[model samples]
Target: MRCKILIATDFSKAAASAADYALQMACLCRMNLAIVHIYSVVLPMVADGTMIFQDSLYDLAEADSLERLSALAAKLNLDADRLCGDGFKPFIEIFSAIGVPAAGIKSFFNRKDMGMIVMGIKPEERYAETLPGSTIRKLIKWASVPVLLVPMDFPPVPLRQIVFTSDFADSEIIALDFLAGIASAYHSDLLIFHNRISMEKGRLFLLKEKKFLDKVAQEIDYPKVFYRHKQKDTLEEALSVMEKNSEADMLAMVHKKHSIIGELFGGDKTLRMISRTQVPMIIFPQSFADIPGPARLGQNQLHD
Candidate 1:
């Protein structure tokens, strides 16, 4: 996944902020970058002779988009050689990316070997609380590549601190392992936060997770280290508890294929959290292959 990065452009401040972050990340990570702007139109034609007029309109729109792309390319100071263009209409389908721009972006990222996708989460007058815009959330839902969602108005940081939630028992710490790997590479603090459900139950869950984490610790040490954010034992209180202490760069999660299904079908807290995430998140699918030999953790043992 080493292809040039893609930053979805809308020419808005929020979109430009995302572009700025992409440029900074590119320089820091030594990754190549691409700026993609998508324009879609629905043309209604009355007579067969209207084909010529519709073609002209399409060409004009495309030319305008390309001109904007060219201006952005210059503003970003990207050498003309590194700039590229990708244009498609309502007709093309990749990974079922029809009618949905986010799907198309995700499909593009996957097929291009792109390591990451970046976009802006637009802001509103309500700044204290932030939300991932509709399209951005859709991409988050679909993309496997790492994504950075810059807030329209929020400031960027070195991302020195990050928080990832885990009941600890969900899968293995494999999810945590991946996050820790990235956070470590950035020298960022890793905070594992999970709600404490009940006095005793939450405590026990904590203990259970800590035990698994210890096993993971044996496998890999974080001298830059780890912290357990014990929040109120209920979902309602969880975020408040975590927020009480400090802020984190990202809230990471795993789409334990089963967990995702349960959240969507079982209507659990994971679903609740998804609908009301205050921070941007990074989601990962479990792995490449599952063997039929045996089962490691029962679903009951893993529900968050």
Candidate 2:
């Protein structure tokens, strides 16, 4: 069974770019695609205690939202032939909801068929203000599926090299297991990156790194996996070095509640990276291991 990728759009230029990226990914990965637009209906403050036009207002808003979604879907369908080539065309669906964006998106998670959620982030200057209390942050925080964030004007290229930041946690392993599918499909190299502040050039640190690599080797069967270690004073500095050196097509990370990513979201560094990075990013939520899907193989089946 092919999984579906849910894309959230507000009809902005950034959102449109994200939709295009998702379309290409769906075709390449042989997954279904869905586009959703959420609109809010704000009613005027009436003098009377009761309002008679609430239902009509909601209906109109929903109608407009659906119409826009349809238009976007049509545009994407036109490019399906070019992207799919001789492969099977992915099934595309469009939907509209009336309420908050985060709540509307969470409703689709109940379907249990979604493998990922894709959204677009504006450029750096706008990202800081756009993230706090925004729908993107809410989804990143609580969504059960992996969230793929595409920066505006990001080049739509095949994913050849992916950089995954890790702390050698169990959740990071689970996230790697899930990402292996895409890496295999794209024939991409998976680079496991770890950064430490300690400048100890001793055998103990070297042994620790070797142990982590050995564990990954025993766990993940992918042959193209590699590891990279760096010494840096801060996460931001480490990220800068990784971004500049790796030349990766995408960045992947696991977001645990108490992890560095979780703490970064509370501040501005992660937001800056999200806005400044030229490549797309895939964030695996803390609950990724619990999500039921073919992409998330069980521990018993992982080695198979």
Candidate 3:
């Protein structure tokens, strides 16, 4: 069976755009699609702290969620012919669950053989106060597979160049290996960007950069790979400059728990970056490399 790309949608404009983006990716990667809708039924509590059992409300919620999911699947199927030419239609599935959005998604994800999770973020979510409770933030923090975030306004374009931010950590090699598979699929350039503070520049930094590139060359056999090193006062500054210079179609990075990107959901600077970044971003969890070889690529392996 082919691997599936799970799309979490709330039926909003942004969610629809994300679904479209995932559809394009699925066609390119020869993968299937599973669209999920997570809903919740809030129960009323009595003064004694007892909750009222509302079977009717629960049933209504489930029914509505299923109806919406079906509609979404139909829409995607209609677009498949136009987006995926030559009658190469991808198999599409729909699912619904009742609970917290993130928890519901995690439960479904754990049971499926999915390669990636794609979700859309609204422009308002870029605000600092709103980032903490955003579902995308929670998914990025915990999802084992890559989480691709598409800004609501981001147009779906062919990925020609993917800019990956790296810190030259050991785990980056594994991340790069995984990304090389994607680059190979699109025949895109994988630009490894290393951002350092201005003070860290000089011969020692150059040596470390050279060593990292050498290791990449030895380990990753992809010929279209390239590297760039830049110094700025902050990661956000470096990212701004890279965005202007790289002309990248997509941005990728591994989320280390202690790294700035990992703290993106909480940090002020990182939140700002998310708010202003226009390109789609794919964030790999720190432990993504730990998954078995087959599972990492969403091949013929069952995830326990």
Candidate 4:
């Protein structure tokens, strides 16, 4: 009945790992967890007396999916009283849908008012990169909420340190408000990381970036803030180094077109950085940051 964290799973090793990670996070935050599995229904070709066979097959598939879902929730201690039959089902909600994965996820979020969405990414092997699949890409593009991508092999760990990549865009302060709420929810420290390219005409860029962050400091009231600025050659290299050196449990970024992420999502460097990330990454779209609700902290208006 509390704020829910929706986790998409396919019962694969990677998805199960993501589910476990979500469970741990939900328990830590004292939030409810919703596990969803999307399955496709295939119809059989018409044949004499085959209608019965088709009906049986359909029933079998649904039953198998439900059984697997119940079994999965049992590990979390949800009994039949809470879910179904004799098992652990009360503590969590499991849904099986026969439709597009992204659409189902979106509908679930709207219905439940989910706090966040967690899904696993099976990083592509081409060029030895960790590129996300089309499903994840679509979900990130269309979902109106924060999407957390857990690498296939990510280990379970306490979310103690969270890093946010800042581009000094006007909407970034709005995004930071959401990120700060998450940091507070988990009792985690926040690190604002900025990687500066040397191509900026002289030192003016650094001065401008500094002044922007100073303005950020004045408007935000979060304690335990760490600011990191690095002069780097490429975005991929800088992000890889941060993951290596920061030991952060999660990374947060805003998805603004014409921003660094826009370039990363379009360029070859996306795979390079995705391959190197050792932690989960949470992306907030521009629309999500613009949502007008409790997150609309009435801070003094932001100015350049």
The candidate scoring highest on lDDT is 3
Clashing pairs in model 4, backbone N/Cα/C closer than 3 A: 78-88, 78-89, 79-87, 79-88, 79-89, 82-90
Question: Per-residue alpha-carbon lDDT of model 1 for 1-304, expressed as tens digits?
Answer: 2345577877789788777666654543435567777776567657865545667767776777777777876766542223222311011011211235776676576653454567766655124433335575566556655555565654544667777766565453655554555565467787776665555465676578678678767754565547565547565366645555557666666544434455446444433444444554555444411311111111111121
Cα-based lDDT for every prediction:
0.55, 0.76, 0.77, 0.69
Candidate 4 segments whose C-alpha is farther than 4 A from its true place: 43-55, 78-91, 123-127, 201-203, 257-272, 294-304
lDDT of 1 at 195: 61
lDDT of 4 at 91: 51
Model 1, residue 6: distance off in Å is 3.0
lDDT of 4 by residue, 151-246 (tens): 887876766888888877767777676567667657788888887766654678868777878877887677866788777877666777767876
> TM-score of each candidate?
0.68, 0.86, 0.86, 0.80
lDDT at 82, model 1 = 36
Candidate 2 lDDT tens digits, 159-264: 8888888877765777887667677767889889887657746897778777777878888868889888778876657776767875678888876555545445
- Would you list the clashing residue pairs of candidate 1? 196-233
Q: Looking at model 2, which ten-residue stretch has the lowest summed lDDT?
A: 295-304
Q: Model 2 segments beyond 4 Å from truth? A: 44-52, 124-133, 199-204, 258-272, 295-304
Per-residue lDDT tens digits of candidate 3, residues 1-304? 6667899999899898899999888776767899999998977656886666699889989999999999988988888888889845789999998888998888766654777889887867766434533677678767878888888867778888888888887778877886787777678899998777766678998888888889999998789999887777766677777678756788888875655554654454434555667778888888887876443663222121
lDDT of 1 at 297: 16
Clashes of 4: 6
